[model samples]
Target: MAVSGARPRVSWSCDPFASRGRLVHEDDAPPRSAFRRDCDRVIHSTAFRRLRHKTQVFSFNEGDHYRTRLTHTLEVAQVARSIARALGLDEDLAEALALSHDLGHPPFAHSGERALNECMKEQGGFDHNAQSLRVLTRIERRYARFDGLNLSWETLEGIAKHNGPLTDRDGNGVGRYAAGLPHAIQAYNEQQDLELWSHASAEAQVAAIADDIAYDVHDLDDGMRARMFTVDDLADLPLVGNALLEVRTLYPGLDVPRTVGEVLRRVITRFIEDVVTETSRRVAEADVASAQDVRGLGHPLVGFSPEVQKAERAMKDFLFPQMYRHARVERIMEDAQQVVRDLFGHFIAQPGDLPPSWQEGRDALNEERLARRVADYIAGMTDRYALDQHARFFDTTPDLR
Candidate 1:
């Protein structure tokens, strides 16, 4: 049964009943809490369904077992919830952030995003994080009262700032990517401030770190499954190496598959435990008593220890060349990028070619607005859909096989 009334006091945790409320006001549902409803809404969104066909590390056609965006989101959600539960944070909020985090991702993984970014470079830019905000606040049109999901303010805050503040207090860009805030996010923030200068809730912090953990572990699993690298190859890669050594010490005669599974299990446990321990230590040291305190702390209250962070970086360093930049993956992504570029070009040149809904206000839109609409249309497409559309427009589309 769902808990009713005020959320029980938990140190550095968000209280559902005391939430910042939604952008478009509405009466509350009786049984489910606000955060729980936010989670359910995201699960039912068209964007969520589309993730099943979107790429993670490999294209969908590559194999049946490779991770899709949907699978990755689920893994992130699971990790977020586990961390939330351990830290007495709001699990629903964490899960919602995790599930919704990738909604903005274009097809073909990072390559598609890169292509889209290049296509939109003149019209601001394309960013998955900003795109996610657009997906939640504008693109999703399920609700009659509002175009977007109209999620609670806390959820929106997490969605916008989960990766950390985009700008400083003066509204200037902060990080490497933040120098130019995407138009979508900037427009929304004008109407409703997402506190772009501050950290998100502790739950959001948990979800963000959980995303890092999920990708680190699952990408390794997928890379091995794809034969990009082997277990012995990862035997010297920091945390993974340590996990492999421990697994071998305990289970000397285990088969490769079982050994892989065991190593992953250990890796997950190690990271989760480290996060919980380190976060608890930080909370105590910083005297963080509430979710707001967590957000205002400037630094993340939930993350791996410095030692673990170093090890994780080492793992990523190894994977960058062996898995991400492997010749086969590179070739496939090149084809995928071309498909994105081709679709964007075709649609921009001939706005009439877009679907009736997409071209609804095409008559009055300026060049930049039209380009954004085309970007939106292209961004929403699945990998197979992109290929099919390319086949429709161009004589030869890359096989992407």
Candidate 2:
């Protein structure tokens, strides 16, 4: 796959991009289109594979049907691909962006991410998006140029921007070295973009929404299976309850299981449709110069329409209050956070425990890189690996390395 810069003249399949003629230039050798290259790099990255073992709220082994981070990513890819295809966007680029969107998420879900962020607070804070960009451009090793994945700027930007606030712009989320680092000021200035730093691609936004859709409904499904909530209990949820009543009234013969499935499916379908329609309409209206140029374009529809948005807001409010905030989930989050914090502390205080690659000098440049190394080690952990590390640190695991 072609690595850096634009390649000219290649035939693009999608509308805006195809209008641009080609994103790759003729001078580029070892030829591949930029978007295809981005897709390949993500597929080959170690971080992408490790996602299989990472938790997506529920543990990987909790049930045969629970979604791991890997499955969640694939679903996002599927959803984004469909939207991209419908909207005349570059499917390869969109799918690549979606598949690698969560590459930097640490073990045990957002709780672990929060803990890692706190641990790195004085070290510039550990945002999974920034870390994912770092992984692609500076960490993941394979085909060699700096021991990193050497991904295209487009893919890296998409990953960093997947959950970025609407105000962010191109290259905005790339990390800047904090004070005391040798080139801190330079890094910050160089990284700053025309807008907010967390900007994601329109395709990335599709993936982000897909992630929300999967987790929101799936978590409720899991809650039911775990007996955390009964059908009656779910029917008691304010928004879901209201929807349930409507569903039952419309289809008197539908059983609770079928009704539950239909409700979630309907919500997801409705939201997805709203997003796709809005995105396509906005894209066509924008008069974009090309598909490559659309990478930094904001989603014309950030979320659902008024009615659906209200229901979605209500659903989120209900989920937070009823499911995520429940004692069982809270306890799991707390445990995961503590485990992450302890592991980070252990690695920092005794750097020798890390692999030899991380044992470099404490010079300013090296210090920044070392801190990143710590983040990488922590970021790469699986839920089980994190638990074992915690156990070893606390003397609960006798045979730990």
Candidate 3:
């Protein structure tokens, strides 16, 4: 029943062997694939571990039960691998991208990123995606032969373009970077072209969507757990509401905790299924032939269906005012941002205050270069470490509660 010369399906997944080699070449260590090595290296990185104390939504002082950056990352990895496996793409590559996605997030998540971006506004701004690339390529020095982990080109490319192309085919900045590219990404692209004009691999796309999924599902869960919202509060919001109705129908008298667990379980599962079905449909529709075909398509092949995307939007619309922008959360985030701002100011005024290692050769740099050096050092701090440093530097620091 099949037409002659027609491909059965679009097979645009990355094959580990076909990867562009690392920035610094090294001999094959064989038993593990390049992507598997990338995952291991990410796990071993100090920046990855620092995520334990970093903010996701709630600060450490707020509550121990809320998700930390590290936990959110693990959830993203799990979702990414599920989506990748379902799509018959490279699961390890997806997982590695998911694990490294947040490595560049400042101590207080988006708030911290905003503060840093403000501090470095003249230095082309601080984009976390760009910082993530820097964390992998420049910071986290554990290699004997190189400054970074020397991950495969595929891994690095995924980290750089997980969200999408940074520029147009002509190398002009696109989207948020319409005026110019971030300094860190631009500097690295000079060393090794991340093909900033094209979409990243299918695996990276998987990681990117997985991040959205994790943020939506988990933030709602955290909101409910914090009592900012209740399970009944989500009883009318499309996908989540449908799940809530199903839970109540199946277990009429279930406790609030049990009902919440069931609803979230269904919500997350539906989101993953929607991704698999929609992405597979797009790939088939596009009739792509190779990984490069996938990348050069100008648009990603990974996402939710229109209906599900609408539902996801509804979820966010609900969360924005009810949870993320809640008075308590705003107050805490404001304090966290001030911590970042204060830390930047303190180090800039007293460059000698920086650790001996960070201060090295900083004397020779011009103003812009010195500011960047200071930014890098502060950007790498864990939330608790940042607070501790703030305490050490000033007479009074914000409570961050």
Candidate 4:
């Protein structure tokens, strides 16, 4: 568990033994801490398996080298674990948070999410963060004792509020959800309070930042794989530009792929090091002594230095136009969105199209209930499965190529 430059466990690190326990109490399964158990549950879940075929930025039908959601999650977990270890936080908690972070993302990346959100606009606008909680607390029905995986309270808290507080001090929705809380989160909060107004544990914050690192690095890799841009294209970029120069200078005349890999490796190192240093400085200066103190700090402790923060933003800016919004990607995503919308419309109109298991119960369910159900089913589909379903229901489905 020891990482280079990492310290022994710190006082503010989340203690797996001191976890708040699961929502539905069960006897301790010996030889594993609660957070470790939560991590295992996520790995064993059907949703986790589905991630292999789900889109990250590229659809499953895209070239094999492109990142899939499962690959992305693995990279995030690796980053989170390293950061957590370096910061003397709970690596298990961090890994659990990272592994479970994207379970709620629909197929076709954000395209499917947008389609589902638009379809569920009246019921409860789909927020993947909230949907993550729903997936953990309700969707995965593996255990007879519980409908969901019944993760530990700490894991649940991180997944619910990992990005930051969902609400302000007054408890109104804040951050990305300023308009109103997602219905899934709101309903779950009534049953088990996630302390929506406070920052999550330092471990949780590590996982969130790890997600950013993964996206910034892997998206660049995928973008290059797709010929959306090249490593040379990042020469003017801030943090990455320096990395590219250093790599080229050190390994003169390296091939494009090796140069890309080396530059990305340096970027990840610089980002992780900056976060560890900045967060350590904050932890000491702020006199944070416990995980509870971390939650109440009102801001994240795990983040890059201001300079690196700007660099991260600059990296995002570069990708937004050069990769994400490339006409090729946009055209594909637009068609992917159509597939999702078509599926939603069909399921809502012909409830019989839903699988027997999905339609087995709830004859008394209302419009909102049925709509949400249809969304859940659609949201769970892999990109290939969705296209398949569309082909099954409609005469002509999007090629999504």
Candidate 5:
């Protein structure tokens, strides 16, 4: 309800970059601010618009009901907003972070990412989170002078730390960042210091949690609808089956469809409740004249609260065995990787070959720009387009949607 001491200026962990924009929330308004405005900017950005054609699980043509990247992102934003509101968080900040989180994701989820990363490995690895940051900060266009829209620091911090721990250039915490450390943590081992600032905002962590919640449940639903995995099949996997049985015990009359729906709803509600309760307690306890003072807060929403975190962990374990770790998904992933690999090899091997847009460069140095240029070209494609390009260039059979 109220905030504590003067909020420190938000700065990039190592770059000494501070947010330049003003916190523009109206004083009378109970729920909005400049960071919130940043979120709105992301929702309206063109990069955010492309999510509709991106993949969530199945291919574009798999079915109309399947989750597209756009739909998934909307779901993530919705979930994140719910948690933010419950926690008395800056709703706009969470909304903007969730909206822009996936902008850099390639067309085919991790598949397109793998291909792009492999191709650009030498230049800079192509993780979607990094690319999303790149998109918002650089690649996404503007009629204005700069290539990037120059989003607020809050929004960009959310993007960078949405995946894991926020780390400094030397791999230490931002002055006050004290949440869970990133697994396999290392200082920016690379020559380029692209590692996101160590002090990712609490709002960003909330978005990350929202992403996990959205996908973990939806992926199972999608798999079931596609007949890739059945309730019985899922229930048979060791501890997962046991958890499913517990759900059955709780509602004996419920069928698998209803049971799955019930479980998902329960988890969603629990997650939201935990986030709201914890976050509100944090904010209300804070010693606040302004929203700006609340920057760099820790994870307001616990990844797993002591009460439901175990269940959440169990649910994730179940999904891991029953859906994500399933061989069927792996096969699809393999096919996708091959497509990316082949495309990269072909494009790189023939440097003279350029996309129609790149034909104007007339010198040998032009070849040097080819990699970055090709990366730009590939990064902009939707999933369906990426496949088409692969097939067109590789003379492979066209994949049906």
Candidate 6:
């Protein structure tokens, strides 16, 4: 039960024992705090299991060693926990947020998401974040009483606002990324009030930054492994280049894999240290006394410093051209989009094509409702399942491999 090197739990840390309870109340189990229970529930969910076959950057058929959604979630959880532990925040809450962060990602990664979003453009549009909320609050039917997992308010709030507040004080949308809030988030906030105008807990902030760190680091590794780019090619990029330089200086003529591995390990370590140092400085500078104070500070307490942020942006720019927009990736993603579009069109036309569970009561629903239902079913599919369905429905399914 003891965590090694754990700082005394600070006032700004979300106290799991004092957590805001779940929507549909249930008796608490002994020994495990509410946040701990939430972590377990997320790990056990059917959606979590499907992540093994879900794309992170590549299709499931691409290679065995590539990062899937499940692996990415695990990496994010690891980084989040490390940062949370350093900041004396609730590690379980951070881990839970990290694990649940990608639950709404569709079959073919961003391509599938784009296709779904376009398909539902009239029905309030598709957002993976909103879909994630729907998945947690409505989709996963497990409890005898509640439809979703019925996670604690703290967990839900963390999930809702992890990337920062969605609205301003007058309930109008705020932030550079905020337009109108997603329909799922807006609807849920109406019922539960996740304080859309304020920042989430520090643990949630840690998880959000951890997501950025994992994406940057792991995508680089995957990109290298897939031969989309080379380590030598990245030797001029920002943080990555610096890390590679240090690795080369320390161990001259190391093999390519070991050299790349060292660079990645260093990249993760440097980012974690930067976040911990910057967050500690921000917490001290703001004189935050409680979780509420952390939330109301008008800026995130957890983030990279200016230098690191610049470097991170540079790295992303490098990846956008060298990896994300590479001809091979573009070709496969194009096929992936077509597959999602075809599936949506087919299911909307022939409702019976959906499984019995998805088809249930869909006949009674209106066009928008049916479309949303079909979207949900499609969104929940793994890459293999999506491709298989495509193969079944269409005469020629593109070999995404």
- Backbone Cα, N, C clashes tallied per candidate: 0, 9, 0, 0, 8, 0
The better candidate by lDDT, 2 or 3, is 3
Candidate 2's displacement at residue 206, Å, is 2.3
Model 4: lowest-lDDT 10 consecutive positions: 1-10
Compose the digit string of candidate 1's lDDT tens values, residues 1-401: 11122334476788888888888888899699999999999999999999999999899888999999999999999999888887778889999999999999999999999999999999888999889989999999987789999999999999888888888988998895456788988899998988899999989999999999999999999999999889999888888889999999999999999999999988988898889888878988999877888888998888889999998898888889999999999999999999999999999898899998897878999999998999888888888899999999998888776
Greater TM-score among 1 and 4 belongs to 4
What are the per-residue Cα lDDT tens digits for candidate 4 across 1-401?
A: 23466668899988988888888898888799888899999999999999999999887777888899999999999999989888888888999999999999998999899989999999868988888899999999999898889999889999999888999878898868888999888888898888999999999999999999999999999998888887889998898999999988898999999999999988998888888889989998899999999999978888889999999999999889988898988999999999999999999999987999998775877999999999899888999999899999888787776
- Which clashing pairs does model 6 show? none
Give lDDT for model 3.
0.89
Per-residue CA lDDT of model 5 for 1-401, tens digit only, reads 22222233322111112344422222222254556556666777877887888877776876898898999999999887776655545566778888888888877788778777777766555667667767776666763655565556567656766655455555665633443232112221131233454435556667888888888778777878877667776665433456577788888988867887776665566566666566545545663223333343333323545655565576677767666666766677677777767766777676456566554462554543566656656677787777887877777744644
Q: What lDDT does the true structure give each of the candidates?
A: 0.90, 0.63, 0.89, 0.90, 0.63, 0.91
What TM-score does each of the candidates earn?
0.97, 0.77, 0.97, 0.98, 0.75, 0.97
Q: What number of backbone clashes does candidate 3 have, counting pairs of residues 3 or more apart or in separate chains?
A: 0
Candidate 6, residues 57-139: lDDT per residue as tens digits?
89999899999999999999999998888778999999999999999989999999999999998887788988888899999
Model 4 has a clash total of: 0
Q: What stretches of model 5 exceed 4 Å from their correct place?
A: 1-19, 22-37, 164-166, 169-197, 232-259, 280-302, 350-369, 398-401
Residue 11 shift from truth in candidate 1, angstroms: 3.3
Error of 1 at 301 (Å): 1.2
Residue pairs with clashing backbones, model 4: none
Writing each residue's lDDT as its tens digit, candidate 3 over 244-336 gives 998889999999988999999888899988888888789789998789999998888899999999999999999999988999999989988
Off by over 4 Å in 6: 1-4, 175-179
Q: Pick the candidate with the highest lDDT.
A: 6
